[model samples]
Target: MQTAQRNSLKLLQWMMAASLALPLALFAFASAMSWISTSEAADQEIQRTLDVAHEHALKVFETIDRSLAEVTEVIRGMSDADIVAREKGLHARLRVVAEALPQVKSVWVFDANGRALVNSLVSPAPDVDFSDRDYFRIPAERDIGTYIGEVLTPRPPYLGARFFSVGRRRNNEDGSFGGVIQASVLPEYFENFYAKIGREPGSFLALIRTDGAVLAHFPVIDHAVRFEPSGPLGRQIVANPLAGARTLQSPADGIERRMRYQRLAEYPIYVSAGLETAAIRSRWVSTVAQHLIFGIPATALLFGLLALAYRRTQRLEEEASRRIEAEEALRHGQRLEALGQLTGGVAHDFNNLLTVIRASVDMLRRQDLPEPRRQRYIDAISNTVNRAAKLTNQLLAFARRQTLKPEVFDASQNVRTLSEMIATLIGSRIEIAAQVPDESCLVNADAGQFETAIINMAVNARDAMDGVGRLTITVRPVNDLPSATTGPPNPHGHVAVSVIDTGVGIPPELFGRIFEPFYTTKEVGHGTGLGLSQVFGFAKQSGGEVTVTSDVGKGTTFTLYLPRVVGEHSPQSLLAEDAPSVDRANASVLIVEDNAEVGKFAADTLTQLGCTCVLVENATHALEELAVDPSRFDLVFTDVVMPGMSGIELAEEIRRQGLDLPIVLASGYSQVLSQQGSGGFELLQKPYSAEQLARLLHKAARSRRLRRDQAPAG
Candidate 1:
């Protein structure tokens, strides 16, 4: 009887323990189901958000890609054009094309001689040359098409807007390049695309050119960026249709994000989209919370009536373990995506600041002052400018904005101009010898830029020789020169400018990256690692090619291959008699400039020049003045790169009305004007002194009379 009583007590104890365990197990199982379902839902939502963002980015890329496609079609048609007979047809067609495709801002054609044959908007000055542009130079290396230019204000003929260009070389029936066809699209057009794509709040998108310029970006991080493959992201998506997208936890927001990337099928562009983690997991957490609230009470009731609960607890613990592992993986992806965004953002902003400061300083040099004080102040300013310039050079080197500007020029003249500078550039310890043709060999190029490039080469040579060495500069034209087998191809009819240096030669390993930005053999502070980069930019910008042949411990030879200007050299017909000049006192002039300092300088100078100058801050104002009275002004002096309508465009409108009044183009970035051929229109380069300003005005006044005489009778 006593043993039976004890057994009954044990049974009761077991029953009570079972009752407690059943509810606990039921609650555990409910919690496990809720968490698993929530995690799956979160993953699904994350994927969905990523998909949506990706799709949005695709649309933006498609828009730009389609524009490139249109450009390609135009180029293909130009290749079949007859150089002599169809020059007019080609120019007219390009104009029609510009009008047809509102997306395209400007179109240009270059002859085999590197001269502007046809431009859609403005006629080039007869003297302007373009043999030194990369679009014409790089074709020799390979058949790489769809070249994108650095962000810049468009030159005349396509003025009033900043643009990025794409280029293609047209081949003759004999497979020789007939000419080059280039399409310059407004920079804002791409930015506008980014703006639309960036509609997503707190989201950003970037479109980088192959050369590493941030062509388009949402959020406007500094306007441009130069990134390298070896950047923090370790590799850049330079290939078509970026390989993949990654997710990351943002250091900025501390939020995990899902990212997706894709490259355009047509243009060389990579697009990426990021989805906030809160957005991705919002639905999942909501569903889980709802389930948890209902399951907790229901589980408690169910468990209260359950007889076996220990087994349920084991099942619940296993489910939680699996869910935790999956969540961890999802979290890891978010981190990688965030890193890419950070890298791009930093690079873009940093470059913008550098460009802004550099440009500002360059423009500041235009102010007039006493010789001694001016030189002293300029020296100080130049020191700072050089620092910024070096920074920009490195940025460009990395971004690949550094390119050649090839053109046919007089080799002897180039050397003669540099003789004085070269004397100072080369130390007393180094002997400099130059072998140049007496007659100017018409090779394509950017002469000023070339001089600087030569200076850099000389400096490098001096450093290598430890302030003692012999440097030889040779210039001559070569027939059927083989194109460079290096970075890009050399166009036909290339003229060679060779810089031979006797010094410690570069190691073979360093040769490959010697032109790379920030990659230097010199100790820090001694070099910014951009000397070779500048050389590269200069060569590419000119319609030419650059190659370096070096032997370790021997020396190095840098050769610039430039296209030749084919055609008989003819001197301009100078009028022996006195030509009529526009009366500045009676002439009303319109001035448009965005920068206050520049505008003020222009207004004051013109007023002092005896002209009735009306100053306006933007193209809009200038246009308004003309709209009120198209014949109100006899001349217009305008800034080419402005916030509103470009001076070139303003001139175009005036020209459209047959207003043959003189128009003067002004800008620090004169290269654009030279490329565009905004002539018979006069040009004044930025940082001009009072003397330069007066001379240009006097020239413009006289040229207007000559043009009036050339006009056809109605």
Candidate 2:
């Protein structure tokens, strides 16, 4: 009878548990259903905003271009000299035309020499030169139908506010490039219209040229700011859709938003509108929170009834077991529920990634897919893999304390520019003072690692100050080491970047061990103590040193001294690979890859490309193969990261042995490559395609042949 009672009690407990979970289950189901609907609604709303912005931009641009055409007719038969003779009359007419359109600030007719003959704003046009501007220069190069110029500030006679121009080129008697007729476009016209449109808080509105130049923006943007064609939104715009909407992070401000963009039908301009992602998420969360608020109390009530019933039917012996079992089941249910939510949240991003791969794969499976389409699909897969590799790199880099890639850049500018970011990092309670001279203090080191070091020190300083104190960062060139007494200074001169904080300073007794790896005074879960160690490691590796001076409860200063270099870096452009890539159809390649699978893939891919290949698992074997026959291979292609000897080290060894073979190093990421950059060898970044491999191999082999031919006779 007692056994029966226990079984009955157990059944009752299970029923109550199920009842407790019912409300939560309903909430979860409701949340899941609403998520998709909510996201679609958000996208639709943004699409509507984009349409408004696009219509406004089109109308404004159309008006400006039309007015420009009308003004151009005024000087159709007249040359610059002829226009100059009738300047006052033409100027009055131009002013009349400009006054008719609020979007157009002024109209001007410029000669081939960029001299303003007549302008709407002023007669004689203030003698301001437009020759150097794109509007004047582009038309001078060719008889462009309508040229849209970059944002520019007008000279003396006009307001200094920014304006873009729509200009048409006039042909000379010989049909040669002549002068320009420009209408200065008012950016405020777009901004004011954008303001009138109803949008969610933190929405963004922008008008941009197809070439990735910003013409105007709603919230106002820096005139010089431009987006890269490679960014997410840029890619979408380049896809040449009539209109599209998606979520992406803005390149200018780094705010993620659900954005929609529409292109002007006849023009090379695209207008974009976006609602901030955080706002959308907040709205969804509010809905979910309401469900949670209603569900939780009901769940508690069911559990309370269960607890009361269990207490009433208790046999102390079985009661303990029942409680433990019931608690465990509840905990398991909670964990499962948490897991479901996490999966639901993460699935969105992963599904998007998978969709790209899956669509590409499905296309590949087509029986009659065109070669061009096939190649595009292949490229898409490769790109998606590269994207996944980057995500993986972030995790690995965090755990592995990834190495640096150094560049020659000004340290003072980095400090000054990073001050605002640091302010965001440390909190508003902390006052930041940055001291960087106008003169550049160039250093040969990794800019990223330098930034990481600065961030670490700033974070530590923030904590030391208890989030409210003056933090000063000073960057200046120093020849002598006043603080780094323990180490010698860089004889060439050192750039001393110091982070000083008026806070609860570090105890001097701990200074020696502070730079030690995994040795942190910060409470557990706060830090792993790798920050200072990394800072110290970077300084030493760059042939410099770090020093710290602290007073207990007073303040502390951490200085990083790096070897200074004496030059500015000329900007390097990353242009796309030339068409009809170089090919070495029957060239011999030595493949050095550590992974069996990767090595097999490289060998197989090269073979398919009509290249004779030899696969080696390590640098030692590769060197042995080269030693056996020095000129057997035309190119040595190796992976960057490896056991025993790295690809970089192998390349150096091959050179040391005086082998004439050209080496192409490949990697997704590596310490040496990151620190010292390509090392003057041709580098093929990992996740490359067969075409990329073929092109690089051909270049390397061709280089080898050239070197041999150019060498003095043996």
Candidate 3:
């Protein structure tokens, strides 16, 4: 009996060991599979990126080829005498072509002896000779279809900038060379294009000749212009077929990279795009790290639970189980503490706003309150409500859920308008200066968000300087986007609104966390820490980015980059068209609202606006009211979010019924409105002021009248 009992105990121990080993083996298998999957996905993404780069390179070459074809045709039907007489017209045509193509810097025709003929830059041509220029000599000597020469800075009569020329030999109609029609492209143009398209920090793009001469290297290297095919990678590139991709280490930077090259069929050059191996590896590692972070903790917890179960059966490992539980409880406590801190900060801010509102209301309720004091109390309430609204807006911005009313406007003008208000807010202790350009710097974005971002930065700067500092707000154009690890790249020619301050700057260690929500270095009760985050969100939502540069002692500068708008109607002009000319008109309005109190408030506001209001609780009731008298109500104002049918749907239904009444959709925040839009109906954001409501009503009334007048006779 004793031997049997001992055997049973040994069997139980074996069972526990096997059970633990099973999960460990499964985890290892899962990790291996995950790594393989991640590696494959990374390679696929690299290939996709390379493919896109190849397409862009091809498109650029195709454009140049077409431009060359057109130029060749222009010079075909001209003789020496005609060339001189038609020089003006030829030069004008070349100038138009060059101006139309951003890549082409100058287009000109050179004689076989390299004497300047008709050039795009100058008329009554200069006595310049390019006889020694490679662009003229190469094609004149070689029997090649088109000759592309090494990049060089040309002498006077042409811009003294580095450019690579593409030349096609002109025939004498006897199969003999007459001259070379050449088009030169500035290397800077390629550099700008490459910079805009490059995805990684260390990535590069290059235009290289088949003979291994680098024509243009984006990020501009000194030795790249005359680079030789000496290194293993270079030799491989030269020996390899016209178009393909490969992985090799760069000799210039010693960085291993994945490169894609495409040879231009029309030209003698090839374009190559490369992404560093480190970038690809970093991306893969990040994905793996995320999986491990969650997986390791989860696996450990599972093992702990299994061990606890095994101990329960043995009834001797209670102390070990208790210790594991204690550790888990500690981790839980830490999470709760973090949650409490975030909620505490938000609750504290709202409480302060509420306290001001509560106190102002309590004072206003006094039976014998004096008129002057009452007005002061009313002002205080209004200020508090505005502050609360701002706080809510900030929260929404940080959450990336704020509904932005984006418009294209001159940012410089807006900054000038706000300069005075900013000065008043920051106080006389801080000197505010605005450096706005005379020319318009148009940007498409939410003007209000832009203003808020600038004000937030200014306020932060004031605190940093202890209220004595010089704040400079400058609006300028950005030729290239800032290099950022995250966020979308700004398009070429973006508008930058910078807020620079001469005050104590941010610390390097805190730079990475400054844009984090609820992450602030300020003293408690001083800030809610969502200012920079809101700016970040606004920039991203506007299809741009926000960047900051600072030193330990020197001042900080915050730049909000927004996509540049070429030409759009200014917001002021649009507002002027929409503005009410006179007092509110006496009209009938159909109000559809689910909330009882909100419906009553709308009715009262419309009554004050000299409008007869027909209040209904739902869309069914609204349709019923409309059925009673379709022509009675001049405008229909409905809540966008309702129980039975949405405001947008109701408007669609009314349109289907051929009703000419104007519809206005109101919403605090509605997904329907966000996705499908108001469908030609005017939108009024919740909590709109009386003046705003009056203007909207007047506009709606006018729209209804215009629609009725435009209808055909029955």
Evaluate all candidate structures by whole-model CA lDDT and list the values in order: 0.62, 0.79, 0.76
lDDT of 3 by residue, 471-562 (tens): 99999998767866344444447888899888889988888999887888889999988888778766765667788899867799989888
Which whole-number lDDT from 0 to 100 does residue 175 have in model 3?
Answer: 74
**Candidate 3 regions off by >4 Å?**
1-39, 77-82, 200-203, 218-230, 238-240, 306-714
| Superposed Cα deviation of residue 81, candidate 2 (Å) | 1.9
**lDDT at 184, model 3:** 90
Ranking by lDDT: 2, 3, 1
The per-candidate count of clashes, in order, stands at 49, 2, 0
Worst 10 residues of 2 by lDDT: 570-579
- Model 2: per-residue Cα lDDT over 1-714, one tens digit each: 467567768877887878767776888789988787778888888888887777777787888877888887778888888998999999999999999998888888888789888988877777777689998898898775888888888766667568888888877778876688888887878888888784467778888887788887767766466878887767876675667776777766778878778888788787888888898888889889987887788788878887887777675636556677789999999999999996775576667778999999999999999999999999898778767766656644765535344566788988988999999999999999999989889877778889989999999899889899899999988887665354434556889999999998888688889988799888999888888877877776565778999988889999998877775453211112332566547778999999998888888888987888899899999988987887778899899889999988898888888877778778766566534444445566566666677676666666767877998997
Regarding lDDT, does 2 or 3 come out ahead? 2
Clashing pairs in 3: none
